[model samples]
Target chain A: MKELSLNILDITENSVKAGAALTQILIDEDASTLLLTIADNGSGMTKEVLQGVTDPFYTTRTTRSVGMGLPLLKLAAEQTDGWMKVESIHISDDPENHGTKVEALFHKDHIDFTPLGDVVSTLLTLIQGHPDTDFLFRHSIRGGEKEVEVHMDTRELREALDDVPLNEYEVIKWIEEYLNEQYNGPEDAEE
Target chain B: MKSLAELQKIKANMKQRIVLREGSGDIRVVVGMATCGIAAGARPVLNELVKDVSEEGLSEKVTVSQTGCIGICQYEPVVEVFEAGKEKVTYVKMTAEKAKEIVEKHLKGGQVVEEYTIGAYQS
Candidate 1:
């Protein structure tokens, strides 16, 4: 993926395929570092599967023999002098709490760091593709003494929307504007 | 400063417009979004479909979604369209421009863009 947001979208698709009721995409960025954590309450992988996940040849899908999602993400992180880690608890091992968490740290100062581009569009695509699943997205940037955050939880929207689908054209448009507004902050009317 | 409170307003408005419409459409547009597809630029194609469908006011008559790998890695970024009484049309090696044309011609105009289909690409 050219952009980190595309990587985020590709990885989250796996979570949705695993039947995750909730997926969380969290990003914490400073001047020099960017940390991405994607957690999902889906059917987790076995120890063997987890161990082989970073390998480009490992995949659970019958259609394709190779899975590039995790491997590409690990490559993207390592190229920036950073690392990627994945942890999972299989459904058979712990039925009550089973899921996967992928965390990657990227040094933004490195020359090979991939930019996080058009994340708002990525989030909208996820929601539109899987209306039944819920997503919690939080992105925070720390600069000096100030911290700016953009947060959204689909669960809360579901409660407020009642029967209206989260992927409804109007609702998705509202969400896009909502996220954009947060990023832009309070616009100056006078200027 | 946009808040969840605005969702209530949308809910009220949507309910009146779509009182009993559960599943929106009879036509399904499925985009392959696997690693191969993403690497080959499926995201833009998917976005183009959604944007055009909504803008054309075909939201209620069509549904655009995504699927995993279909074992055709060579033909990444594939799109399949399914209608009520017609055969599924698979479009391969799709770009954003091609997707827009498909929406306007096949979807809105009710005629398949045969040159973009898998049959043309394969044969």
Candidate 2:
């Protein structure tokens, strides 16, 4: 993907398809390094499934033969002189605690590093497409006068929404402005 | 800065509209967003569809969502439209511009843009 946000969207789709009720997308970045973590409370994979996940030929899907999400993400990370890792515990193995966590670290100073594009749009798309599922998004930047963070949890929104759906047009629009305002800061928004 | 408090105001406002239209949308716009599709640029197409649908006031009648691969990787950025009483139309290699045109002509004007369909590209 041209933007790392696209990769984030693609990987998170896997979690949704796996029937994850809650997914957490966390990002931590500094001047030289960026870390992205997508953890989902979904039906985790078997050992064999985990082993083949990074292979472009391996896929749990019946629609097509190839699964390119993990492979492409791995390439993107490694090309930036960084790494990617996956940890999972299948439901068959441990029903109480079964989920998947994918972490990709990229050295932002490297020439091959991909930009984290409009992530607000990515989060909105996720909410719009899968309104029933919940998402927790937190993005933090470390190299500033003070650490800055942008946070959102659907669990909290769901409580506030009551019977209204999260994908309601006004809800989505409000979220877009909310996130953009956060990213831009109140002072910048005033300008 | 925007806050969650404002979402409350929106929730209150949307409740009236929701009660007026209780059922789901009659048409569905599904954008393919698998690896091939994203790498080929489906995000912009999706954003355009969502923006256009809302701006054109077609939100009540149409729903724009996303899906995984349709097993046609060659046609990287594909879009499928489903109407209540019509055949599914697949548009391939779509861009944001084309998405806007589709929204205006096919969605708003009730006339399909035949040249953008998969059949036109193949034959």
Candidate 3:
């Protein structure tokens, strides 16, 4: 759970720095299942780049960039008694079609993505910091046969945040709402 | 909480004012947000710029933006300012404190912090 939150924060930072115009996040957690994905329309990587990114030794540079975040995410997803996959395509040729997609799925093994909450905090942090960029966050949790999407009204938390840019204090509060939506929503909010 | 949709209002307002500000030659605050920039904490600087500028009602005359790596990673998160018909000034190793100084000393008083600029390093 804690690992997932850190993964999200790290991935989003990569998306922003990748020169993405828009970044998308989809997190669906139900009592029995959890599916998470982060996608970006940034400078896509080539097949070579994609193959290398997941490598622990892979990095953007030899200095300052440890390049651990994405790979760590891959690890958390795959090790979480679930499934994980990553894909990317270079958009330089057809810029419109270029994008990188990363996914992590957790099933009933109860790997627990409940801790280290603050998805909204995580998402909102990226959005607020990069006003020049656009981001979409879609989250859902399972019910019976349906998935309930907990729509948070926390975007307005932007104004109250005042001069702070996703500070730890504010981020903690935002995470609370995120946890509620994922773990505390109606039995079947998706339907 | 604000709706993501309401960001339209911000955009709409920026659109309407962009032309006026450009024509009128307002002070533009440019933050270095390249990979080096964000990793160096450009996010907080950007937020401070947005919030302070708005709170001070300086939004009409000052605008904030993000840019990619400037190859000057050692000096990031840098901020540069371009005023009408003036030489560009780049501030290196900028924190919230330095950002505010740029606002008060340069943006408002029309005087560059010659000591804190990239030129300072070149010298």
Candidate 4:
């Protein structure tokens, strides 16, 4: 339902929320399918955790955990005749070896994936575009294999890492709100 | 292909704005928008500047623009404010709420929020 960008942005926000150090987003736009993939280096959740994530009422955080991301992501992918799968390894060679990868698929002819603003807005969330974080985005469209790559670093937005101030938060939120306005195609776009 | 003259005409129209001028009576806020800025959440910050300025009726007094990159990607969502007769104030890690505060304090009151300014790090 709606454009796949909304799902893409939604899932990506989850990645940012998962305390990911680096998030990589890959979008494949073709005649057959408009595919979006988001990968992050956050703590890997177990099968039970993953299952719990899909349950709207279950939450991992004691604070606020509506557990809507994975479910919504699953729904969006299924609606587009695509599927979302999560693979996690608890026992890895590295301590920080946790990771999560979510993929959303879409039938190109049946859906409009040309509106890229949603994808942009999703990736520019509050936690995103931070100095400590780095993102690699690749978009392919037009079947010419025509493509574009956008690498956004947090440093470009701000430099003071010692302590985050109120002004900094305002500027970032303002930008987030701005992107939400520019990319209006998706209502459930983590707006 | 489009005609070169048409491009020239478009340029002429854009020139009416005179974006990069030596002396103008407008408050210019530049947000770095390279890959880093976007990752640093600069797009929303820039967008809010436009919305807030317009809503607050500061259209003629302030203008929001985007830059490719500011090199420093850490303090993203960065916003640099420049008035006609004042120093350049760089507000780092900006958000929608903070943008409003800046509008109220610095933009309106002619007072810079020193806490938000990247004082020693001015490059």
Candidate 5:
């Protein structure tokens, strides 16, 4: 994907297809590196599937032949002198044990790394598209010695709604504003 | 930032339409969103469908959704329309503009646009 947020959207779609009730996305950036992590409480992949996830030619979808989501992410990380990892375990009896976590680390200063696209829109799209699934997003950025973090939890928003549907137009607009306020605090407002 | 009261106002105004849309709809519009589809620019197509459907007040009759892939990488950015008691119509190499046209002719006018369909492209 041209933008990191698009890649996030693609991978989270995979989590939804896997029957995940909750997906957590985290983006942490510092002076030296940027880390992206997506974890899901879904039907975990088998050991074999996990091993081939980074291969561009291997895809679980029968539609078309190639799966570029993970492979492209891995390539992006590697191009920046970084790496990616995937961990999954299947234990039906234990909900915690049955899930997948994917983490990709990239050198922040590398020219090859793509910019994070409209992340606020990406989050809203996911929330509106899949109302039943809960999502948690955290963005933390550290420049020099100062660090700031912003977090959003859909479960909490759901509780505040008193059964109002999340996909309502007004709710979506509110979410956009909420993300903007949280992501761009007064101290580091984007111009 | 706007308060929840604003949302409540929208909710009250839209409650009836929302209920009808969610209760039943026979028409389904599905956009392919796999790796190939995304690379071929399916996001805009999907967004256009959702926006037009709601704006045109066709939400009560047509539902828009996304799918993984349609097994046609060559036809990336494909969209299929399914209506009750009618054959499914598949549109190939879709764009936001074409999606809008589809919403107008196929979904609203009840006449499929032959030029946009995959069958037309093949022939």
Candidate 6:
């Protein structure tokens, strides 16, 4: 992917395809490292699938002969002296307990690492696209002693909406503004 | 940040239209958004479809959605349109500009832009 947000978007789509009812994304950027974690309460992959997930040649979809999401992320991470891991636990009776987690770590200063582009747009797309699914996004940046964090929970937003859809144009515009203000600070708010 | 009061007004206006569009055999515009598609520049095409459809006030009659890979990696950035009681039309190697044309010629004008179709490219 050209941007880290695009990679996040692609991986989250995989979570949705895996039948996730709730997905949590955590991004932490420090002076030296950037970490991304995507966890989902979905149908966890089998050991066989998990083993071959990083192989671009392996895919579960009949419409496509290759799956590039995991592999591409792995390549991107590795290019920056980073690594990735995928863990899954399959549960037949309780889907809430069955899920998968994909995590990748990259060196923040690495030249090969792509920038996080328009993350607000990425999260909003996922939320609007899957209205029934709940999403929790946590982003944090740490430099020296200063740390800034932003958290967005769709479940809480839904309750506040009182039946109004999150994808409503007005609501989406609000969400975009909310994310920007939170991520970039109020001083840099977009007019 | 805008308040919930504004959203309430939008909900009141959109509820009926949204209900009518759901599960109905409306014109469905599906954009392929797999890794290959995105790498080949599908995001802009998808965004254009959403923007144009809404701008043309065809949101109630048309649904612009996304899908995973369609198995045609060579034909990246593929878009498929499915209308009620009609054959599916697949557009290949789509760009934002072509998406606008499709939105106008096919979606709004009710005539397929056959030149952009995969069949046209092949034959």
lDDT of 3 by residue, B63-116 (tens): 676565666878987998877777778899888877777777787777888888
* Angstrom error at residue B103, model 6: 1.8
Native-referenced DockQ of model 4: 0.04
Docking class of 1: medium
Model 6, A78-175: lDDT tens per residue? 99999999999876645458899999999978889888877887887777577788899999998847687988888877877767777765566667
lDDT of 2 by residue, B17-37 (tens): 989777969889999987788
Highest TM-score against the true fold, candidate: 2
Q: Each model's fnat?
A: 0.74, 0.62, 0.00, 0.04, 0.16, 0.24
Q: Where is model 6 chain A poorest over a 10-residue stretch in terms of lDDT? A: A182-191
Q: TM-score of the A chain in candidate 3? A: 0.72
lDDT of 6 at A163: 74
The TM-score between candidate 1 and the true structure equals 0.94
lDDT rank, highest first?
1, 2, 6, 5, 3, 4
Docking quality (DockQ) for each candidate? 0.64, 0.65, 0.05, 0.04, 0.30, 0.37
- C-alpha lDDT of residue B81 in model 4: 90
Q: Which regions of candidate 2 are displaced past 4 Å?
A: A144-147, A187-191
- For each candidate, the alpha-carbon lDDT, in order, equals 0.92, 0.90, 0.64, 0.59, 0.82, 0.84
Q: Write the per-residue lDDT of candidate 3 for residues A55-110, one digit (tens) a residue.
A: 77788865445456666666666665777787887877667787778888766455
lDDT of 4 by residue, B1-123 (tens): 122243334344434444543354478888776444554555557656656776675655676665544655678768899876777888887887888888888877878877777774465
Q: Rank candidates, TM-score, best first.
A: 2, 1, 6, 5, 3, 4
Candidate 5 DockQ vs. native: 0.30
Better of 3 and 4 by TM-score: 3
Give the TM-score comparing model 3 with the true structure, all chains together: 0.58
Off by over 4 Å in 6: A62-65, A93-96, A144-148, A185-191, B2-9, B16-25
- For model 6 the local lDDT of residue A29 reads 88
